[model samples]
Target chain A: MPGQTTASLPRVAITTGEPAGIGPELTLMLAMQAATLPAQVVAIGDPDLLSSRARSLALDIDIVPCRPGDDLPAPQAGRLSVWPVSLRAPSLAGTLDPANGAYVLDTLDLAIAACRHGQASAMVTAPLHKGAIIDGGHPGFTGHTEYLRDACGVDEVVMMLATDQALHGVAHGDTSCPLRVALATTHLPLRDVADALTAERLERILRVLDGDLKRHFGIVSPRILVCGLNPHAGEGGHLGREEIEVIEPTLNRLRTEGLDLTGPLPADTLFTPRHLATADAVLAMYHDQGLPVLKYAGFGRGANITLGLPLVRTSVDHGTALDLAGKGTADPGSLRVAVSLAADMARHGQ
Target chain B: MSQAQPCIALTLGDPAGIGPELVAKLLEQRDVVGKANIVVVGDRWVWEEGQRVAGIHHEIPEISSLAEARDQTGPVLLPTSTIKPEDVEYARINGLCGTSVLEVLKLCMDGASAGQVDAICFAPLNKLSMKQGGLKHEDELHFFVDHLKVETPVCEFNTLGNLWTSRISSHIPLAEAASHVTSERILSATQLIHDALIAAGIEQPRIGVAALNPHAGEGGTCGREEIDIIAPAIDACRDAGYAAQGPFPADTIFRRARDGEFDGVVTMYHDQGQIALKLMGFERGVTVQGGLPIPITTPAHGTAFDIAGKGRANVEAMRHAFDIACRMGRHHASR
Candidate 1:
C-alpha cells in the first residue's frame, strides 16, 4: 500500500478498436479488473459507449472522465480512466456501421499520438474490422499493423506474437513454451511470398526484431532462430534457393553486426524443445509458416506486439468478433495479456 | 476377420537401427499378439541380437520358407534373410545393412503381391545406403511405386494421434510450393488421402484441407491459391462422393482436428501441417504410405543412430505403426 501511488507506474492508453464490434465490450471487461496490472490504463473512446457496454455486460467499473489536458488518476480497483473521444455515430452491439470508421481511426490516432508525445508510456488496441473501416471510406487499410506503420512513419516494422505459457501435448509427449514468431513478410500472396522474401527485406526485419528484443524484452544477447522459406529449409537448396542464397547471406551479415542468429533451419523441426532451448524467438520467413504452430501452442492466449516502432505498442492477436459483440461471450484473455505486456514493456523498455 | 485373421508381413527396416529391437519388444504385448497373425520377415540372427540388446528373452518360432509362413502362424518370425551380429555394425549406415533392408522390403512386397500377407509394417530405412545398394528411387514412395509397377497414385502420409496430413507438394522448394498448388494436384492428393483413410477403416473420413497462405489468402488479398485452386478441389471431391472440407487457414485447422472435428487433413505444403503436428506430438507420429496397392505403415521417426543399441528408444511410434498396419490389413482384406 505504501508504494501504491508511486510515480514508477507507466500510463498506458487503451484504444477501443471498432465500435460496432466487441472492442467496446472487451474494454469494459478488462478495465473492471485493472488494479492488478503494473500500470494505469486510459481507455481512449466515447465514455457513453463504455458505460453502455458495462451496463449491458453487468460489469461494475466506475468510469472516471479525463479531458485532454487534465490530471490522470492512478489505476485502482473497480475503476478505469476515460479520455473521452466523441463517437461519429452511436455504436450498437452486433452491427456493422461504416459511418463510425473514422471514429475508430480517431481513437487509434489519439492513442498513438499520446504514446509518441509521452503522455502515455504505451498503447494497447482491441480488434477492428478492416472491411467496415474500408466501407467507411479509408483507402488501403490493411489492418492496425499497416496503419500503425504509416502512423509511426517507419520504413519497416516487425509483427510478433508471444505468450508466456505452455501446454503438454498428450499424444506426442510434446510441450509448448513462450514461443515468439516475428514475420519477415505478412499479408502477401502465396505467389508473392517468394519474391517478396529477399536479403534486404530479411535484414531489415532481423534488425528491428533484434533491437526490440534487447530494448523491450531485456534479452542482452538475443538468440533468434530463423525459419527457412522451404519445408525442410530448402533441404540444401533442393526445396528452395532462398535459404541457401538470400536468408543465409543476410544472417551471415547480421551475425557480424553482433546479433546471435541461428538457422535458416527447417521450419518443421525448429519448433521443438531441442532448438528452442537456447533461443529467445523464432524469425519465421512468412505468415502461415510460423503462426499455425505458435497459435496452436499458445491456444488463443497470447498478445501481438509491434516491434521497431518508436513507441511501445501491443494488441490482441485476434480480429474483431462482430457476431459476439453484444452477447458478452467473447474471451478477454488476449486483450488482458496485451495490456499487461504493454505495461511491462513501458516500465522496462525505456 | 472371423473367417481368417489378417496375416501381416513385418520387416526389419534397418537391422542396424532400432527396427529389430522394436519388433522384438512390440511382440511381447498380448494385444499385439491377439490382433493379427503376423509373419515377421527379418534376419533371425539380427532379431536375436536385438533381443540380447533389448534384454527380452521371448522365444519366437522361426520358419524356413514364405510358403510355410502363410498357413501356420500364431506368430512366426520368418527368416527372409540372415545377418550375423558380428558382421553387422550397430547404428552405422553401410551398403551391407542397406541391402538387408531392401531385401526385407522386397520379401514383404512379394508376400503382399502373392496374397500371402494382407498388409505390411516395416521399421525405418535409411536412404543413403539404400542408394548405395543401387536403390535408384529417390524416396521409398517412388521405390514402392516403381516396384509395385502400378499406375495408381501414391504418397507418404505423416500421421499423429488420430490425424493424418497429405501434402500437395513435399520435399520441394518453398518458392516452387505455390506453382504446385493447382486444382489437379489438390484433387489428386485429396483423392489419395481419402482412399487411404478408407483403407485404414474409416467409413467416410472427414478431411480438412489447409490453405497455402497465412489467413487462407485473406480472400485473395494475401493469396489466391485458396479461392482459385483449393476451393474448387474441395468442390470436386464433394461432387465425386467424398466428404472433404476446407481450404481452412492452416493455423487453426489443427485445433479443430484435435477437437475431433475431422479425422484427417490435406495440407498445401509439407511444413504447413508438419510444424503443428510435430509440435503437438512428435514421438507418437506414424508415417503411413498412403494410396499404395498394399497397406504399409512405419514409425514416423527415423533410426535413432544416437540411441541405437542403448535400449533407450521409445516404442510408442512402433506400437502405433503396428496397430495401424493390423487395422488396415483387416480392412483391406475384408474389402
Candidate 2:
C-alpha cells in the first residue's frame, strides 16, 4: 500500500559528491534502480560523469538536462532528471583533481538553493573529499553537516545515523519498532568537548531529535537515553564532577518539561540488547563515542540525517571511496537508503 | 618456611570514608585470599567498625611485621592508631582519622621498599581530608614520589584491557599542562608504557600517542603542539626500537585503542585518557603507577563520599587492582 501510493510522492534534490570518488558511480546506480524509490529525483552535478558511470555499469537510464531559468520538468520513470553545472574539465572517475573542486561546491550550492527556494522538498548528498576541497582554495568545511549549516544560514544542527528498523530494530512493546540514535556534541576535540557540553546544548539537541523522531518516523514521545561523559557517570563525582555538575542537572531539567528521557548511564554497557530494546534513541557524548557502535551495528547501510535544519537533509554514512570509484562496483545500499529517508522526511514536513 | 607468597600491602584510605567498608567487602571473597595475602594498613578500630557494618564476625590478626604476616590465615591488620571506633563518623573528615591514613601509607611504603611486600594496592584517599590533616603534599602519589627520590619517569596508567598512560604533568593548571608537554617528557612516557606493557607480556606492543591539538594541529591551523612536540617524540621512540605511532586526532584515537589497533595510549592530559578509559570499562579498570620501584595499583576511581558506608560500594575495581598487582609482582620476580 505504501509503495502503490504515487500521488503523495515528493520531489527530491540530490547533490552528487566529489566527481572523482564513488559518488558519481553510486548516483548512477541509484538512478538505474530509481523505479523503486518513492519520489521523483533531480540530480545536481555534471551530466557527463553520470552518463559515463551508467554506461560503465551496464545500466541504461534516460538523462534529462535542464538549463538555468528553464522550467523544471517532471521526472520520467527509469530516467534521471539532472541540472548540469558546467565544470572546467570532464570529471574522471577515481581521480581527484583540485580543478573540479569548484564544480563540487557549485553542485551542492545549486541543490541546497533549490531546496530552500521550494523547488525541491528534500536533499540527499554524496560524500565530499576534504583534501581536494581545501586544495581548491575554498575554506574546506569540517563536514557536510557544518557546510549545510553555513550554506543554509542556520545556527545549530545535529547529526544522526539511522538503519532499518528491521535489521537493527529493538522491540518497544508487543507491536512496535522504530529507528534511533542522536549525537549531542559532534566532531569536537577531546579537550574542548567538556566545555562545549552544557545543559542547554544537550537539551536543545535532544528536543530537536525527539521532535524529528515523532514527525518523520511517526513515533510519539520517543524514549531517549543519554550517555554520560565520564566513566560510570562520574561515580557521584569520585571520578569526575561533570556528571553531577552538568549532565544530571540537565536531564532533570529536561524531564520536568514532560519528555520521556532517562539516564547519564555508563557509556560502556549502555549499548546492550536489553537497553536498546526499550530506547527509541540513544544520545552519545561525541563522534567516536556513538558513531563506532552505530556504524558497527549498520555497517555500510547506515544513513546519516541532519536534524534542526529548516530543510530535510540526509546522506550515506560511508565516506567517498576514492579507491573504488569508476570501477562500477561501489555499493549503492547506503545512498539508496539516504534517498528513501529524505523522501519520507519530505512527505512528513511542515 | 614456605616461600613468602606475594603480598599486597593494601592501604585503607580515609578511615572516615568508604575505603574501610570496600576493603571488608573485598576480603569476604574467597577468590581474593586464593590470589594473594592482603595486609590491610589502617586503624584497627576502623576495621572492627567495617566488620560490624558488613555483619561479618571475623577475627582481626594484629601483626607487628611482614615476617609475622606469612603465618596469618586471614587478612593481617597493621593498626596505626589508638583512637576508638566510636570517635570516627561515617563520610566526615577528622584530623586523627586522616593522619592515620597517611601513617599507614608510609608504613606500607617502607615495608614495600624493604621487599617485605611484593606490591602495594590502595583504596581511594580523600585529598581534602589529607590537607585538613596537615599533610604537606598535593596527593598521596606525589608525596610517595618525592619521598622515594628515585625517579625514572614514574607515570600513572589506567588499564581496562585497553591501557591509557599520561604524558603531561597532572593536577596543574591547563596552561601549565600544555607547557609541561615536551619531547623529552613524551618520549619518556612512551618508553615507560612500552617497557611496562612488554614486561606484562605484550610482545611488540603498539602504542598510540594522542595529539595535544585538535585534528593533530591540522597542519598548524589549530595549535602547533602536536607537530612541533608530539610527532618528534613519537619519532624518537620509534627510532629506539619502540613501535609507537600517532599524534592522531584525539577525537578518534581512543576508538582505535578500543579496536585493538594499539596496545596502549599515551594521552597528553588527565581527562583525555580518564574519560575514554572510564567510559570503556569503569568497573573493571585499574590504575597502576608505572615506573615505581614497587608496582602500585588501585581502582581507576575515587572515594564515593556521597555513598560512603551505604553498603553499596562496588568492589569490582578494587578486586581488579589487587589481581593486577599480584600478576605484575610475579612478572617482576621472574625477570
Candidate 3:
C-alpha cells in the first residue's frame, strides 16, 4: 500500500514448499481468504496436494488449475488458482517424503520462471526441507536463497529478515516501520566469520542491500546501521580488527558513493531505540550478531526478504515446523505477512 | 562466622559519584541492615554527605577504627574521612576522594583477612579516579590478590540474578582472542565459575562453555578452534566431576542462559557474552571477582559521572551486588 499507485491488482506466485511440510497446509489457509488479498495470487504446487491439505484443514476452497500462458481470472474468497505440479507420492500430515522433494523444487522452478518473465509481480515461498531435498539426491543443496540465486544466475545476493510489529501499526502507509537485518556471513562458523568478511564482499552486500531497499521497499534514502564483527565493534581495535581492516573501509567506500551508512557500532547497544530510531536497515557481520536480537524482537511475526533478487521475493521467517505440519498448529502469521509485503513490493516496483 | 550474625565490611568506593549515595539509599532498607552486620568503611564526612545527598537522615552508629568494629544490625562507620564535601566537587575527580577509597579498601580487606567480617561488597568505584589519586593497582582483583597473597586462578565473573558468565580471554583483541583459547584456559574459567556458582549456593552448577568458533566451528569448516580447544576443555571439566557443557554458539547460548538453561556460561572472550548480558539486564548486573580468598563484588556499572550528585542513580545493580555478597558470604563462611 505504501507504493501502490496502480489500478490493477498485482499478480503474485506463491510456491507451496515441501508437500510433507506445513507449506501445503499454509497455502490452503491463504487460498481460503484469497479474495481479501491486494494482489492476484497464483499458487505453484500440485493441485491434488492443495485439495488434500484443504480437506484436512476443513477449508472449503475451489482450486482453479492454470499455467503461465493462461489469462488469470479475478480473485475471490475460497478460490485458488494453481499452477499444477504433480507430486511423486501422496503427502501425509506430520511426515517427510524425500521422494516428493523434486515436486517441491519443481514448484520453486515454475514460480521463479513466472516472476522472471513478469508473468507474476513477485514470489512468496513457504518453508522447505533442505535435508529431504538433499536426500532426494540433490547433493549440497544449501537453502532457498542459494537455489534462487543459482536459478537467476546472479553472483551476489543478500538475505534479510524484518518485522513491523514493533512500529505499533503506525506504518500503515509508511514503509519505515520494519527493522530489517541483513547478514554479512550466513551459516558459517564463528571462526570463519572473521575471515569470510572481506571489503569487496562487504561493499557488494551493501550495494545490493541499498539498491533493493530503495527499489523494492520505496525508500528514497536508506540509512543502514552496520554492526561490527567483533564485540564493541572491535572496541577501537582491541576486541578485533575486522571493523578497522574490512568493515570500516568498505563502509567508507560505500558512503562515498552517497550511501548513508553508519556503524561498525557495538551489536549489543545497536538494537536499542537510540540507534534504531532513524535506521532503515541494519547490516550485521554474522548471523547470530544480528539475528538473536532481531528474532527476539520479531520472532512470531517476521518475514524473510531476499534482497538483490531480480524480482521481489519474500518468505516466512520460520522453517518447515515439522511437528506442527499436519496438526493445524503452525502459525500462518509470518507467511501472511510475507505475502502482504511481497504484494506491496511488487506494486512498488511497477 | 562463629557469631550468630555475619558481619560485612562495606566500602563507599568513589566519593565524588553515585557510590556514596547508593550505599546511603541501600542502608535506608531495614531488610539489608538486618541481613548482615554492616560496618561501613569511609570518612564520616563522606558518609554524612551521602546521607545528605540521598536525603536520608538515619541515625547510624559510628566507630573510629577497625579495632572498634562490632557485629550488629546498626551500621558501624569506620571514619576514613579525609576529603570534605566543601573541598571536593560533587562530580569532579578529586585525589583525596580516590585516596579515601584506597584507604577504606585497606581497612576492609584487613578486617576480611582477620575474619572480622563475613564478606565485602563495595559500591561502584571509579578506577580512573583511583588512578588519579596515585593508586597504582591495575584492577580491584589484582589489588585483592596482592592483599590476600594467595596463589590461585582468579578472574571476573558477571551475574545478572541467577545467571553467571565467566570468560577465558578477557580484555584482549578479538583476533588474538582465538589464539588464546586453549583447553587449559577454558577448563580454568569453567572451574572457577563452577566453584563460584557453588559458593553462591548452587550445589551442582550447570555451566555452559561457549565455543570460540561459531556453531562450535561447524565441524571444523568455520574454524577448528572449537574442535581443537573448547570441546576438549569442556570434556576435561566434565571428567573432573563438573557439569560443564557446550561450546555452544555464543549468540544462541545467551538466550538459553537467560532462560535458566544453565547456571553459568564460560565464554571465549569478553564481549561474546557481554553484549548479550548487558543488553538483557543493563541496570541489574553485578560483577563478582572470582578465584579470590574472599568473595568480592561491585555494581557492574561504573561511576555515573554524568548523573552524579543529583541522587537519581538507579540502585538495582548495587542492590544485587549486595545480595550476591550476602549469599556468597554465607556460603564462603562454611567452606
- lDDT (C-alpha, whole model) for all candidates: 0.81, 0.74, 0.80
Put down candidate 3 lDDT per residue, A15-69, tens digits, no spaces: 9898878888788787766767778888898898888788877889899998787
- Which tens-of-lDDT digit does each residue in A26-72 have in candidate 1? 88888767777767778999999898888888888888889655667
* Model 1 alpha-carbon drift over 4 Å, by segment: A1-6, A67-71, A169-177, A256-258, A298-300, B1-3, B15-18, B39-53, B57-64, B71-100, B127-135, B305-309
lDDT of 2 at A33: 75
Superposed Cα deviation of residue A125, candidate 2 (Å): 2.1
Task: Supply candidate 2's per-residue lDDT for A41.
Answer: 76
Residue B50 lDDT, candidate 1, scale 0-100: 73
TM-score of the A chain in candidate 3: the value is 0.94
Error of 3 at A302 (Å): 2.5
**Comparing 1 and 3 on DockQ, the stronger one:** 1
Residue A120 shift from truth in candidate 1, angstroms:
1.6
Residue-wise C-alpha lDDT for candidate 3, range B1-335, written one tens digit per residue: 32445677788878888888999998888788877778888887878778888998877787766655554547788777567677678777777777777778877888888877778899987665666676665466777788888697888898888899999876555556667788888888988998888776789999898876655676776778877777787899999988988878775788788778899999887677776776667688899989988888888876777788898888889889988888877776766
DockQ for every model, please. 0.67, 0.10, 0.32
A70-159 per-residue lDDT for model 2 (tens digits): 544544445888889877667777788888878888888898888888788898999898888878877655667888899878777888
RMSD of 3: 4.8
i-RMS of candidate 2: 6.0
The residue-level lDDT of candidate 1 at B13 comes to 78
